[model samples]
Target: MNLLEAFKQTKFQLSGHGNRNIKVLKDAFEQMDEQQESDMYGSGKIIEEFQDKLASYLGKESAVFFPSGTMAQQIALRIWCDRKGLKKVAYHPLSHLEIHEEDGLKKIHHIEPVLLADKNSVIELEDIVGMDEDVSCILLELPQREIGGQLPSYETLESISTYCREKGIKLHLDGARLYEITPYYKKTAAEISSLFDSVYVSFYKGIGGIAGAILAGEKDFIEESKSWKRRYGGDLISLYPYIVSADYYFDKRSQNMDEYYEGAKTLARLFNECEGISTLPLEPVSNMFHVHFNHSKEKMEQILIQLYEETGIGLTHYLNKTGEHSCYYEVSVGDRLAAIPIEELRNVFNLLNEEIKK
Candidate 1:
C-alpha cells in the first residue's frame, strides 16, 4: 500500500503524527561527504562534533549520542542514582520512562521510579512536595506526549525546578518532544533546558531524522555515560547517516517550530469547533493532541479506510485506558501538515461527522 493508504487501513487519523521529510540514504551520504569524507567507521570525530554542537545548542556542557532514547534515558537515570547514592527517581505516572521504554529503567538500571502525577496532569511541585526524601532525580517531559501533549504551567515548572534544587535532587528532562514545545511555551530550548540538570532530545522526533537520541549534561555525567553506553552495546560502528540527517533537519527546521505551533493550533481549533469530537488535554501544548470520538471502533475503522482509499491521508490507531475500548484516537501535527489548509481539514471533520450520522 502507498503511505497514505497504509495509514488509513488502520485508523482514522486527522493528526499529523510521525516523522516526515527524512533525508534519504543518498541525501544523507552526500551531506556527510560534504565534510572531509573518512571511511573509518565508528563514533569518531564527526560523531563527537555532532554531539558537541547539539550539547551547546541545548545549553549543556556535554552530550552523548545513542542509538535510541530508551538507552540514553535509562543510562541517564542510572548515572544519577549512582552519583546521588539514592535508588528512586521521581517522574510523572505517564512519563515516557514509566509507561514506555518497556520497563527498561527498572529492569536494567535497577532504579525505582516514583510516579508523581496522574494520567492527565503534568508533574508539578505539589506532586514533588509530598515526597519526603531519598529521590535522586526528577524526570519531567516538557509536553507529556501521551496525555494529548499537555504541559505544566510555566510558573509551576519553575517552582518544581526550584523545589528540586532546594531538596538537592537532580532534574533530568525527557525532552523527546522538546522542539515542538518551545514555540507554545514562548521559551528557547536552552532556557527550558537550563532549569534541569540534564536534558535528552530525540533526533527522530520533530527534527524528522532517523533513529537517534542525545543526552546532554555535565562533563562528568557524560563521561560516565560513555562507559555505560559501551557496556549497553550502543556504541555503533558509524552513526554517519543518523548524525548527518539529524544535523540537516535540526538546522533547517529549528527556526520553523513556531510555524508548526501555529498550524497545530489552527488544526486543533478546527477539530474543537466541529461536533462529534472532543480534544484531550483541553488545549494544544505542542504539535500533538488526541481526538476522542463518540463513534464505535468499527465505524472509526471504516472512516479511516474510506479516507485513505479515497484521499491519501496517513493516520495511526488509539488505545483506551483499559486497552479494550478503541473508539477514541490520536492526531500528531507535524511539518508535513503545514501545507494542508486548516479549512480543508475541517471538511474532513465534517465528513467524519456525516459518516457517523449515517
Candidate 2:
C-alpha cells in the first residue's frame, strides 16, 4: 500500500501531524469569509494583525511575516550585517542556516558563517566567549534540532547573551520549534526571546501552521527586514490563508506542548528499554529524539509497514541509516502519540524489538 494510504488507515501514529491530508488542511481554512481580505504586498489587515500577535507573543517591538524561514533568517542576517559592517555570522555547524539553506547566506547575502562547536554537542558559552573574530551576529537554535533537540543551560545562555551584548554582536534566535521547548525550559517564549536582539520563529514545525515564519525585533530592525523582504521577492500579495492557519493551530495545539514534551521522554524511556534500540540523548530534552536500531533503513521501513498492516499503528515514516546494521530515525511525540495508551506503546516497542532481534 502507498505510505499515505497506510497513514490514513492507522489508528495511532508516532510523529506529529506534519503529513496531514489535504482535506484536513482544507478544513483549517473553512473560516475564511467573504469579508476576509488578502494582504496587499505585505500591507493587508489580516497579515498585519497576525504580525502584531506574533510580535506581542515574542515580546518584540515589531514583527514581519515571511513566506518561509529561509527568507526570514537570510533577511535578518543581512540587516544585522549591513548595520554592523561585518559580514560574519556565527552559528552551530548543524544549524538549518548552515546545512539546509544551500549556503544562501554566503552566496546571496555575502554573510560568512563561522561554524561553532562540534556537530554532536550543542554550542557552549565557552565557545562563544573564546571566539575572537568580529561578527555582526550569532545565531542559536533553542533545542538544537539536528542533535536530538538538545538545549544549553539557561545559565549558559545568559552568559552568551551578556558576552554578545558587550561585544556589540546581535543575538538572533532560530526558534523554529520555540513552542515545543517551552515545557523543557520551564520558561515562556517571550522570556527566552527577550535574550536575543532578533528572533525568527516558524509557523509550521511545532506550531503546526501551514507554512510561514515570523521575524521579530525592535521596530527599526524589523522595519529594515521589511525592505529586505521586498528585495528578496518575498512580499506576497496575499498571506491570509497561511496567517489564519497559523493562528488556529497555535491556539489549538500549542497549549499542549508541555504534555508532548513529557510524553516524548516517556516514550523514549520505553524505546530505550527495548532490544536493539537506543534513544539518542537518552532522556529527551524536547518533544523529539533519535531512535537508533540495529537494522538497515530498508529493514526498518519493512517493519513499519508490517506493524501498520497488522496492528494499525504507523510507527515512523522514515529512518536515517548510520552504518551497515545501524540506523536511526527521529521520533516526534505529539498529540497523536499522547492519545494512544502507554501500554500500547510499550507493546509496539516490544514487538519491534522482537523483530529486530530475530
Candidate 3:
C-alpha cells in the first residue's frame, strides 16, 4: 500500500493532537450550552469576550478575531504602511506572506515586501539593521516555521524590538505557533508578545482548533483591522463556530505547551538516532521540527509504507523532496505521541534504524 494508506491504517501516529475530523468540532461544542448565542458579523458576547481574553493573554490593548491569518496579516501590513505612508515592509525571505499567500499582500494592498535574511536561516537583528531601504514595519515569525522552527535568541528579539521602536518602525509578529515557543524561552505569552507592535496568531495550528486567527495590538490598531476585516470579506454573518472551537481548544491545550515541547525533543532524538536520518536544529526550539532522510523520496516512501504495515506506528504520511537523493517532513508533537506505549515506540525506532541502514 501507499504511504498515506499505510499511515491511515496504523494503530498509532506520532504527530499532531489527533485527527482533525468533524469530531474535533463536535468535542469542542459538546459541553456548550444549547442556548448560547452566536456572534453577529463580529459583535455579540461570544466573539468579544474571546477577543478580550486573548488580548489580555497576549498583553495587547485590544484584539480582533479574523476568519484567517491571511486576512488579518495582510490588513496589518496595510495599516502599518498607511500610517507611515511608505507602502513597504521587511520580513524573512521564507515568510508565509512571501511563499504561501500568492502575493495577496502585494496584490490587495500594493504593499512592497523587502525580503531579509537567507532563505534557510532565521532573521537576526543584524539583518534588520543592515536593510538599505526604509520600511514601515518589520515582521518576524518566532521560531521561524519555514526553517524547521528555528528561533532567534530572546536577547536578539529584545534588540530587534528596541531598534524598531527607536526607528519608528512597527514590529509585527507572525506568531502562528507562538505558544509552542514560550516553553523554550521560559516566558509568558504576554512577555513575548509585548515586544511586537502587533501580533497575529492562528487557532488551527498548535492550538488544534477548527479554524480562526486573532489580531492583537493597541486599541486603535485593532479597531482599524476590524474595518479591513470587513473589507476583505472576512466578516461572516456568524463566526461563532470558529470562535467557540478556538476558545475551547485554547483552554484545553494552552497549558500543555511545555509537555508538547518536551515531547518534540524526545521525538527528535529518536529520529536522529536512526541511520540516514536527522532533524534540523539538532535539537528543537519548539514542539515542531523537520525530519530529513538521506534516501530519495521514492525510496523513503517504500521504506515507510512497509514500516507502517509491520509496526502499525505512523511517523508521517508525506514527504517533501529536498534534492534528488534527499527528502524531509515536519513533525509537531501533541497529544497523539502520548498515546503510544513507550516500549512500542522504542521498538518502532529500533526497526526504523535497522531498515534505513540497509
Candidate 4:
C-alpha cells in the first residue's frame, strides 16, 4: 500500500491531536446550549466575547476575529502602511505573506514587502538594524515555522522590539503557533505578545480548531481592521461556527501546550536515534520540528509505509523532497502522541532505528 494509505490504517499517529473530520466540529458543539445565539456579520455576544477573551489573553487593548489569518494579516499590514504613509513593510523571506499568500498583500493592498534575513535562518535583531530602506512595520514569526520552528532568543526579541519602538516602526507578530512556543520561552502569551504592536494568531494550527484567526492590538488598530474586514468580504453573515469551535478548542488545548512541548522533545530524540535520520533544531524550541531523512523521497516512503504497517504507529503520512538523496516532514506534538502506549512507542522507534540502519 502507499504511504498515505498505510498511515490511515495505522492505529496511532505521532503528530496532531486527532483526525480533523466533522467529528472535530461536532465535539466542540456537543456541550453548547442549543439556544445559544450565533454571531451575525461580526457582532453578537459569541463573536464579541471570544475576541475580548483573546485580546485580554494576548495583552492587547482590542481584538477582531477573521475568517482566516490570510485576511487578517493583509489588513494589518495595510493599516500599518497607511498610518506611516509608507507602503513598505519588512519580514523574513520565508514569511507566509511572501511564500503562501499569493502576493495578496501586494496585489490587493499595494503594500511592498522588504524581505529580511536568510531564508533558512530566523531573523535576528541585526538583520532589522541593517535594513537600508524605511518600512512602516516589521513582522516577525515567533519560532519561525519555515525553519523547523526555530526561534530567536528572548533577549533578541526584546532588542528587536525596543529598536522598532525607538524608530517608530510598528512591530507585528505572525504568531500562527504562538501557544506552542510559550513553553520553550517560559513566558505567558501576554508577556510575549506585549513586545509587538499588533499580533495575528491562527486557530487551526496548534489550536486544532476548524478555521479562524484573531487580530489584536490597540483599540484603534483593531477598529480600523474591522472596516477592512468588511471591505475584504470577510464579514460573513454568521461566523458562529468558526468562533464556537475556536473557543472550545482554545480552552481544551491551550493549557496542554506544556505537555505537548515535552512530548515533542521525546519524539525528536527518538527520531534522532535512528540512523540516517536527524531533526532540524537538533532540539526543538517548540512543539514542532522537521524530520530529515538521508534517504531519497522514494526510499523513505517505502520505509515509512513498511514501518506503519508493521507497527501501526504513524509517524507521518507524507514527505517532501529536499534533494536527490534527502527528504523531510514536519511534526507537531499534540494529544495523539499522549494516547500511544509507552511500550509500543519504544518498540516502534526501536524498529525504526533498525530499518533506517539497513
lDDT of 1 by residue, 47-80 (tens): 8888889898999999988888889988888888
User: Candidate 4 regions off by >4 Å?
Assistant: none
Q: lDDT winner between 2 and 4, please give it.
A: 4
- Expressed as tens digits, the lDDT of each residue in 1-358 for candidate 3 is 7889889999999999999899999999999999999899999999999999999999999999999998999999999999999999999989999999999988889899999999999999989999999999999998898889999999999999999999999999999999999999999989999999999999998899999999999999999999988988999989989999999999999999999999999999999999889999789999999999999999999888988988999999999999999999999999899999999999999988888888
For model 4, residues 58-109, the per-residue Cα lDDT tens digits are 9999999999999999999999999999999999999999999899998998
Of candidate 2, the 10-residue stretch with the lowest lDDT total is: 17-26
| Per-candidate TM-score against the hidden true structure | 0.89, 0.95, 0.99, 0.99
Off by over 4 Å in 1: 1-23, 34-43, 314-326, 341-343
Q: For residues 69-149, what per-residue lDDT tens digits would candidate 2 score against the true structure?
A: 999998898889999898999999999988898989999987889888999999998888878788999999988988888
Pairs of residues at least 3 apart in sequence or in different chains that clash in candidate 3: none
Once model 2 is optimally superposed onto the true structure by TM-score, how far is the C-alpha of residue 237 displaced, in angstroms? 0.8
lDDT on C-alpha atoms for all candidate structures: 0.76, 0.85, 0.94, 0.94
For candidate 4, the TM-score is 0.99
Superior candidate under TM-score, 2 versus 4: 4
Model 4 error, position 77 (Å): 0.5
